[model samples]
Target: MHSLRPLIALLSATAVAAPLRADAQTFEPLSTCVSSLRQELPAKVKPETFETFTRDAQDLRPVVDTATKTQPEFQLPIWDYIARRTDEQRVAQGRDIVKNEQAALASIQQRHGVDGATTVAVFGVETDYGRVRGAYPVIDATLSRACLNLQSAERKDHFFTALWLVQEGVVRVDEFKGSWAGAFGMTQFMPGTFAKYMSAADDKGRVDIIHSVPDALATTARYLRGLGWIEGVPWAVEVRVPPSVAQRWNATESEHGCLTQQSPVGKCRRVAEFAVDGVTRVDGQPLVRPNSLLGQQLEPSLNAALLMPAGAQGPAWLVTPNYQAIWRYNRADAYALAIGLLSDALRGSAPQRTPWPTDDAGLSRAEFRDLQAMLLRLGHCDVVVDGASGPKTSAAIRDEERKLGWVETGRGGQKVFIALKKSSAPEVACAAAVPASAPELAASAAASAASR
Candidate 1:
């Protein structure tokens, strides 16, 4: 089964995008899922809800399956991912949301200790501030995801819980619509998260994250707090890694003990630890100071993970625990960074200072699909032609690199595509089989033979 983190990211990106239409062969009935739910969730869900849910549930199995295979995190370059999510238009819209929703956002900040800008940023990224909430019926999407063999047991549990919410009258099945992966509401909460952290801002005895902006923002703030967002700490700060510093902490290393073992976002150490090793801010200033958020500064002892999204030569970041909280919302570094950067933009901070290292940028979705097709033709990969770069595609890239005696970074880029094309060129193949000097040598051999 694919990882749930990428699945969540995929769902978030495609929630507003059109869903794939499935033919009869691709579609599967929800009878198995209904049976399993009855067996597993009898105590938590009532029988009538199960009957109603099954009656209403449409098989979106094909859509969920395709979506899981083509997640944007695995397909897009980090720079592209961040750029699309935190574009100038998104930043402008986010600022407007911050202005218009000030009172409601301030109330959430006071109650949950999560900043309003950050909450608004989450709202913008999750569903474009409720403008592009998903179109799929949540009951069908959840049931579809729950029944799939590729889905994890934990995911199945969560889908069942969503049905239970419908059964218990927490949310109506008719009104429940969301992404193909079952995340709903303005801020895109999974059913399990909604069950735990759904909140109501006003005295009305309801917590509706689906339609109410204030309720959604408050719920989002509550969710972030539950994920361990510190009140006044910034999620991440731009930093500079000195050229003189040793290369042991480079992200490419497979063995770094605790640094490699962290979950979701992965890797963390105290800022002082990197300071001891010569890392500093872009202005060459020491990073021993406290983390600042809005106007408040946090103590310097907080642990932060160093990230180089584009490798050693590119931009660097010191991501705090609050960054991890953002990551918990969608477990991609690119997604978290987009949220942080967008929030900063909404608050009038400058854009990214450093550029990505490579001149070849990266492949687009179409380019990646072409790369996958080329890999398939070369017999290096055997996966579906989805744009996502899964383990099989990465290994295939490494295999091709090995054949060309190039460095085995396993990253798909324009260079890789060019190399594949050049290697497959007829002229290049002919030259490889017959050296450039072969014609001259043939003439010389003929002259020698005639003389003899």
Candidate 2:
């Protein structure tokens, strides 16, 4: 029983914490530590290909115990996990893959200044526009925790990132595979970030990201110009402020004496003393501003970080240093605000006409699976419907929106489909109440005790 499912599937990251430095001489114990570190790896990889890749990395440790028991046993309902990533059929197939890849996304934004709407919002938030690049087995999810030695230097840093994608032939050992955290193409990346920022020569000399749309939009603008991406700045925006401003904005920059209205003293008064086209003095009086848009007017000295990750009630932006270089591809804040709101909705920018605390009747996916089948007929939650509202269906829709007095709203909206359509009717209307019975043997014994 000591297997807390390999420490909750290696600390299921939601906010970049996967760093885990590990040492005590790379500790041992997971049964003679994966056969003494498979004798320090690399022998041009084969011994019946390391025993059929350790029997397919011991069959994906039961999909991290079936995505943590399918999220809570058929009681799932944050409007079925945000209606599977804001679906309107995945935003009308991400507006036809941004209009049939506009000349391969404007020659990958003129050779990697990185913007084609944040590379089609990182191809519409990692594999939706391409549609789910994850079934698993990128060398069985990087040798199943680098052979279950767990965080041993971040699973030998994703096991030498699947042996540097098979020594740069960019994946082929049964055509590799992806996600259960190995991440793959069409924006999921992660072969040590596609070998530190992949790019293919766009103005036309070829560079493909598994089948060129000008090499996956210039290998995601040469992996956000090797993670310092700043071309025209703004990978964060949605500002509208004015409730007399000061909404804390993640405090500590010496608690606001850095004049924090989220650093708007025209960007911390030329943050670190002047030069974007240099000239400062608003209340003091002088102006010039035009630093660099990167195209015909480029100028970067690099220094930015203002991230507003959906707090203080949602949109607000400033983040730069090419927005933490798109958090090295996929370290979420809703995966970098869905690739900075699909690069401002592929330059057209809608869906956020500032109405994300919904209720003017916006709750579909069959009303979020009829409010997760009325939160599994009312005993609260059971998990799967996959419309997605996550964090245990916003803690069972904020515990049934605090027992109906409502206000808890971690948002599934339409008041969680009118409180699960008033818990699927029959409360008094001249009938014997009924409706309950859908437990399916405690959701089939919690999905068969999570595939054990």
Candidate 3:
């Protein structure tokens, strides 16, 4: 992830939700930004190009500012984030994509030494295989971020790059839309990143990442390859750590330490070193090269760092330099783990072996939707069943949590899901703010169905 953008994942239950209005108020005006940029725009972006493109730029500071703070990585619990991102529906869709786009994926692997699953996993995570390329115009989004952070050279460069892309007809002006932080395309590349790596995979013409799947995947593969993604090598492998070593190395306070400063196991070591230190493969395979890694001509001396995303007692992965490459892509352990797990799932690997240390486990996207629907039946709150946890959904879940006498986390965890699932009908005023009759009628209609 960009230093400007921050981390990825489901926002933690403890994260303080920022109201949109409060966040939006912090920004330089559009007129002020345009004036400053006219003089300070990078030399690579011609002054006239900046003037022509940003003339109609919208002040998106309010929305962008809120979005920057609400990134899931910094908010959601690790388990919830992983469950939502690597759920069954996403896995099935990834498999279908792997089948349909096999040729392009194969070509990418051949050309770049990047695996198809990893490439497609990035596709799934970035823009949901091009389904959810953001709504903000790249010009507006970039300009908004630039105005928000005047000292950030990356944000300013991205804005000008967006302008240059539009002016060159490489990206149509109408199609220049992306995230609040200004990343766009099927694989959500920042404008500057796209300019550097967005070449056609087939070498036929200019890469059209917005319109071409192969080109988007190609750009992603190229980036990963540039980041040193090793072919046929896993990013990491789930491992079992002996209790003796686990006690000494476990640092729940620094859960993402392996990716942040250095490995928590102190330093990167050869596979033999890990085996010697009592780290064993989870699947009863050799520590040096597990069965999943066999036939790849892998050596025992391949470097790996111990990654305990939860704690030493919880799931730990012996992450290789391949994991380092993926971490370099986003610099978040959860995001890299998502990519690793999703890619493995696409390749017919079973789900995660070791569970997180929490009893109130996370729900999948579909299960989350079901929870929302069940909440509606139990008169918890009337909200969309889209599975995205918004203010209304969180508040509703908190109400249910309060009813159960648990601490109010407001997260749609399995505890709330199971409780709501078993509740037959509306027993209380769902939303005291809303009319009591509304929830009663809806719950009455769905009562018989909810009982089952």
Best by lDDT: 3
Error of 1 at 140 (Å): 1.4
Residue 11 alpha-carbon offset, candidate 1, angstroms: 18
For each of the candidates, give the backbone clash count. Answer: 0, 19, 10
| Rank list by lDDT | 3, 1, 2
> Total backbone clashes of model 2?
19
C-alpha lDDT of candidate 1 relative to the true structure: 0.65
Q: What lDDT does candidate 1 reach at residue 200?
A: 87
lDDT of each residue in 1-452, candidate 2, tens digit only? 00111111111112111111232334334445456556766565554555545543534443433343332212222222333445566566676877877777777777767756677766665555554555455656555545554546555555555665665556676656555545555665656555556677454533345555557667767766765666776654343443323243332122212322334443333332332222222222222235442221212332323333334454444444454455434422333444565566556654444434323334644566667556655654444454434444456677777877766654566656775775654332222232322221122111111100
lDDT of each: 0.65, 0.47, 0.70
Which window of ten consecutive residues has the lowest lDDT sum in model 1? Answer: 443-452
For model 3, residues 256-332, the per-residue Cα lDDT tens digits are 23433333345556668768888877876667655565432334667667777676646888777677776666656
From the highest TM-score down, the ranking of the candidates is 3, 1, 2
Per-residue lDDT tens digits for candidate 1, residues 285-342, read 7776544523323345566677675667788877677876776667556667778988
| TM-scores of the candidates in the order shown | 0.71, 0.31, 0.86
By TM-score, the better pick of 1 and 3 is 3
